[model samples]
Target: MIRKTMTVLALAASLGAAVGFGALPAFAQTAKATVDAGKAAGTVGEQADGFLAVVSGGDAAQRAAVVEINTGRAAVYKDTAAKTGVTAEAAGQATAKQLYARLAPGQYWKPLDGGWAKK
Candidate 1:
């Protein structure tokens, strides 16, 4: 019984390793997919820093909303990456500012208009 158990354990370990090794290529493919998505999106990393910049001016509520938007973008990136075999993260990092610029303008505060005003 002891010997049988040992053999079974060894087999399981080997199988796990094999499965893990097999996953590496898939992971690499996922990265490529993300890049493709970024290109297709035409706005990968744009959200993070842009969201941060806008959040700085708004109230706490605004900050939370911006964070939610950024998180949503990341989730999309992950899904796209998983499907296409490109690295969306890398693409986002590479041209975040450019991407942000391309993005539609977000909330803007106008003091004279009378909402919030400036501190």
Candidate 2:
């Protein structure tokens, strides 16, 4: 069961990276970094707490999670991309594309959702 899940995940990530509207593992890498940064800084946790603390806040909570995950994870990829001379915008675009591809309908990374300007 575990192996199957892992395979599926790997496949999905590959698919996402491959047909990511021209983006690839590169973009996903940065997105992951951003998520890590948020987690390490506890921002992701804070956002989750703040969101859950309020009423009718499920959306908020989910949104916060996305933010935390996206920001932290993206940072990781961003740093690597930077050292390698990859443009932030390219990273951002890759992040956005991958996030969109990975997320289900009505769910997505906040920074990547309709916030193309920032990306």
Alpha-carbon runs more than 4 Å astray in model 1? 1-55, 91-119
Point to the candidate with the largest lDDT. Answer: 2
- CA lDDT of every candidate: 0.36, 0.38
Stretch of 10 with least lDDT, candidate 1:
110-119
Q: How accurate locally is residue 20 in candidate 2, as Cα lDDT from 0 to 100?
A: 27
Candidate 2 regions with alpha-carbon error over 4 angstroms: 1-60, 106-119
TM-score of 1: 0.36
Q: Distance from true position, residue 116, model 2, in Å?
A: 10
Put down candidate 2 lDDT per residue, 40-114, tens digits, no spaces: 433332211111011122444445545544454455445534544554444344444444444343332334222
